[model samples]
Target chain A: MNLRRLIVIGIPFTWLLLFFLVPFAIVIKISLSDPAIAIPPYSPTLELSGGWAGLKAFFSQLDFENFTFLTLDPLYYTAYLSSLKIATISTLLTLGVAFPMAYGMARAPEEWRATLMMLVILPFWTSFLIRVYSWMGILGKEGFLNMILLWLGIIDEPLTILNTNTAVYIGIVYTYLPFMILPIYSTLEKLDLSLIEAAEDLGCTRTSAFWLVTVPLSVPGVVAGCFLVFIPALGEFVIPSLLGGSDTLMIGKVLWEEFFSNRDWPVASAVAVILLAILIIPIILFQRNQQKQLEGDQ
Target chain B: MKKLSWFNLTTLTLGFAFLYIPMIVLIVYSFNGGRLVTVWAGFSTKWYGTLFHNEAFLDAAWVTIRVAVATATLATILGTLAGYVLVRGGRFWGRTLFSGMAYAPLVMPDVILGLSLLLLFKVMFGSMGMTTIILAHTTFAMCYVSVVVSSRLLSFDKSLEEAASDLGATPFDTFMSVTLPIIFPAVLSGWLLAFTLSLDDLVIASFVTGPGATTLPIKIYSAVRLGVSPEINALSTIMIGIVTVGVLTASLINKRKVVQRLKDEKTAN
Candidate 1:
């Protein structure tokens, strides 16, 4: 029985290790190698005939240039900072919009809860790319919003809303709002009503009771939702590329250009490594929070 | 008691409006008779007819369906295995590492993941195509399926399996007959989730797809770059309709099952 269990689990474990883990290792390895035309570029070979130099040539090529370029270059820092700023703002906006919606859903009568939740998730059925494209029609200069605004006499000219930071922000929040709401809803559903009642009985106002009892307990969900939105937003390529104009320089766009346009695999891999490093802190914190929750339950 | 504030109602209305207005516009514009996508030229089904005749759209749809079905099936199988391990396996060597590796794809940026996979294929396999795209989709889709299945597995009872084993059934037979049936609902849900995600993917598909392997999302993306058209809206509406029907049907069936189970439980009691 134990052996059978081991075999069942071992299949997936081995599969992931070979494909997922090894591919990443290969990326890191190639990132450390020299950019050359060889079969496996920068791999040191003893034979000097095949443009292969000794180990010294390989080690010497692996210098601080990649790391230095990421820091000293103005473009990289700008992209990194802008990506962080956009992600943070969008995450906050999504929270603001989602919290009340989720709260309303949670407090809604049981019969209505599922229907409301379905409404929230229905948009997600469409392709994410198409949904992003739909925003283009709505936000374009000659599109629906401008047409409606002009008819209503709200504005004389179309607004330049399609290709701007504002547009990217809208796109991110729209795409990720369901992610924020679902986690928050799940957490809120399990919250103990007695705690809020206790606060009310102790002479606390409704707002104060919420601030003291409700919000604190739902921190795990809030953190998880924020991580979900923030992390993806940081690496968002499609939304920013389609909605953002020249002004919005995100890391994902830069990475894409580096790999596809420049064919700079080493530099691109270096950028990926740096991006992975940036993500590690939040990933660790989120994992720790999950572990703590599990252990607390135990 | 404080009166219900107008502020809550106004915000709620605005929120729902923000979510629905774009979709509503898309649906309305799809039926517009005008050559221009934005202008109202009265209602017609011309765009929907145009969509039917567009061979490229049809071909891309076929490719997407093929990829989604293949990815969903393979990912669900692998994910169920992984979920079973996480719930039933021992704390053996590299267990934490395995679990983390399985999940890493979910949080990793699509651009990074796609680029890395592309680079790996170039270095080792010497090509970028459907096979690579399927593999990449499976990596992340399996993670979602595993998470779903494992959550269900956590609440599963083990004594049934133990009893089957003690009653002279082989371990494989016990799992196939007893354990599989119990967790079949979760596995089915996982498959549906994978199918939806695979259909919805664009970023990874763009990076890894080759000359002839373009998916529907990729086709829409490239077309949108030129400009929006009524045909695109028609396609979007069709996709939305299909998915809506599927989700509603699934929920209805689940509700029926729940009612039936309740009745059975009452009768047993």
Candidate 2:
């Protein structure tokens, strides 16, 4: 490459290497080191004696004790499995709500589509903490939902919703709805309506045409949306901590408590590393899908 | 008339209601005279008034603004360069890896990203505060900015730059005079995105922040955990109002540009 090209690529490459890639390596290193009562709460891997020999000693001291401890602790296993289950359920719930809205927006009059799109994304622009926080008033015992239900005579007593898995579901689905909607809407908006029309003109009904033509074409968008929601939801700390009951044992919260409350940095690092390893599968899949889409466009 | 079908209308209405009602209640109750967020005795702006005087809230807000501005500007610059390079620098070494790094943070869990970055900072810098927070925010925010700018870059017209170069302008000159101006709007949007993200961040900020570097989100989180307060509702309402105005203005500007372009095409035709 020429000088200009070299400068252009080198900045981001080096920045990401130092900030993103190196940090992940540090996480793995910290995961292997034993927890200490030191300020950082982890044993120093590199006791800088001199140069190369110091590095060799540091490498030699690394152990898999944290990883083994994670397996030995039943709480870790429960947290991981519960997080996975909650993430999966929330992803499905988000998709269910987002799909119809996206479809409606995609099928709206051309003149209104831009405004509709803006409206969908407008909520996302606000503080996510605030958005989740708002649910407190709406889902609490004396909150609006219960008040409305009581007034409507739907229930005799206010059903407890806050600090429950249901609340977490509501929060997750509510917060992530836009992530699901935007991608699917973009794909659906670009869809060849003529294909659906052609199917309709044949013996197929409109619903069948939708299922056969639109659904199949929107799979990439659906996949992208699911991954977007699932990956973050898997390690979500805010929603579950804020909205979930004590029984909602998510790995993200567990990891946070392990580090901050228990002062177990190695265990936290191990949890994060394991989480990253699990998420890598979906990340790679999403990247490959995006690459395919890009090639298709080209 | 191309109107929504009943099913479509129901879907839109319910979905929108679901999205907005909680926010609307929060906003509405922020003005409640009563202390309770749920019970509205009458309209009052007490919470908003109190928010202005709260020293902790004010300090966090100031810190947040500083971090947001710093992160937004730096991220936009770095992200623009990265995006331009990704699009224009053809088949360079480690290009694929660079692209992956740029996009990976989008889906990487905040917990993992925050933990890893915190570990890096503790080992390298040995202290955490405003600088570490800015670095962490910029790291993630730049990825978002790059995504925004690169999408714009994908549709960029290379002919304009080529024509500028053909007229004796250098590559840098062509970029500055021709390419940058054309893509300035995208860069601006990217900056706004980065700023908003920096403002919205809590988990990552919590991990990296030191004693005096608490942000608005972190403060709000701690306060909310104590229990829902009308002050938080008022604060949230103010934030929501600011964001709404910002988004609407941006959308209006973009819409006007689209209309102007369409009118130009019509007149030309």
Candidate 3:
């Protein structure tokens, strides 16, 4: 029985150790190496020499230069700061839009909740790139939104909504709305309505009761929703590249350019390592919240 | 359910409009007789024909479908094992690390994940290809699959397995007959989720793809970056149609199952 259990657990544990954990270790190792002009773009970690000399050469090659370079460069600093700014703003915007929709869905007739939930997730089921691509048609100079505004004489000229920070905000909020809504909706769905009703019966106005009762109860959902949106949006590459202007300097875009455009693999690795370090706190908090929720349920 | 208020109605209408108007516009213009995606010069389906005739696009689509299927299958098996361990392993050594790995990828930034995997592949294999892309996709997709399956396992009844073991069934036999059947639906849904995620991925695939291994999203992303056109719109419309049908069908089946369960309980009572 003991052997059987060991085998059952060993397979997945080993797979994750190799594929998941080892790859991350490689990223850290590569981040410590020097950038090179050759194929693979970073100085080789292993020397071709056999035995102790090769081991010595590998250890000698690793350094802190890439990380030091990132610290000295204003562009990298700006990218990191701007990414946090964009992610924070976008997370708030998504919450603002999603909270009402989720509240409505939770408060809807019980028979209709499933269909409503499905509708919220329906957009998510389609191709993410396609959904973002569709926005180009709607937000461009000659796009649908501009054309409608022009036809109505609302503006003398088309708004340059595409390829701008505004566009990035719109894209992030749109792509991540479901993430924000689903969590909040799950919490709201399980609320005992009588608590709100009881508050109202005690002469608390509906609005105040909502603020005092419902909002406090739903804090966990709000936090989870924000983390879900903020974490991914912080490193979002496709949306900013497709919709953002030249001025948009998100760290994800900067990392992509470093790796692909500039061929600076070492620098990209350093950027990734730094980004992951920044996120570790939120990641730990998110995990703790999940563990707490699981224990609460059990 | 509370009575629907004006606030609820307005929120629903406006929120859904914000969510869907762009796709609606894109689908409408896919049939535009004009070259511009936004301009309607009466309706035409020439772009659909053009999309079908594009050899590169077709090749990418084929590669994407194959990768998605492979990813879904492998991720399902690995993730099911991980999920089982998470809920049932009962204080095994290194269990915290196991659970953390299973859940971390759920929120880990895609760029970091992609870059880390790319570095790993370069060191190990010296090149990127479809195999590398499959490996990356399965790594993350399995995380999602694990979440789905583990949640289902959390609510699973332990007594059923105990009963089977009491009746002289071996552990494996009890799992095969009792636990597997009960969790099969969650596993199936996990496969579907993994498949869709694999199909939808672009950033990771771009980071890891080699020559001739371009996936559909990579192709569409590059094309859209340069400029927008109706052929891409037509392709998007077709994909949207397929996804819509798939989601609606799945939900309908799920609804029917729920209804059947309710009826069964009523009859038993």
Least accurate 10 contiguous residues by lDDT in model 2 chain A: A41-50
Q: Which CAPRI quality tier does the interface of model 3 achieve?
A: high
- Two-chain DockQ for model 2: 0.85
Q: For model 1, how big is the iRMS in angstroms?
A: 2.7
lDDT of 3 by residue, A1-298 (tens): 4888989899889988888899999999899988878877778657566589888878887889999999999999999999999999999999999999999999999888988899899998889899888888888998888999999999999999999999999999999999999999999999999999899999999999999999999888999999999989999999999999999999999999998899888899999999999998889899998888889888
| Predicted candidate 1 versus true structure: per-residue lDDT over B134-235, tens digit per residue | 887888899889888887877778889899999999978987999889999999999998999999998888878888999998888888877788999989
Tens-place lDDT digits, model 1, residues A58-88: 5565655666777888998899889999999
Rank order by lDDT, top first?
3, 2, 1
Going through the candidates in order, their DockQ values are 0.57, 0.85, 0.82
Candidate 3 residue-wise lDDT at A60: 85
Chain A TM-scores of all predicted models: 0.90, 0.96, 0.96
Q: Give the winner by lDDT: 1 or 2.
A: 2
Q: Which residue ranges in model 3 land beyond 4 Å of their true spot?
A: A48-50
- lDDT of the candidates, in the order given: 0.83, 0.92, 0.92
Q: Which regions of candidate 1 fall more than 4 Å away from where they truly are?
A: A1-6, A34-60, A295-298, B1-12, B267-269
Q: By the DockQ metric, which is better: model 1 or model 3?
A: 3
In the range B191-251, model 2's lDDT, one tens digit per residue, is: 9999999999999999999989999999999999977899999999999999999999889
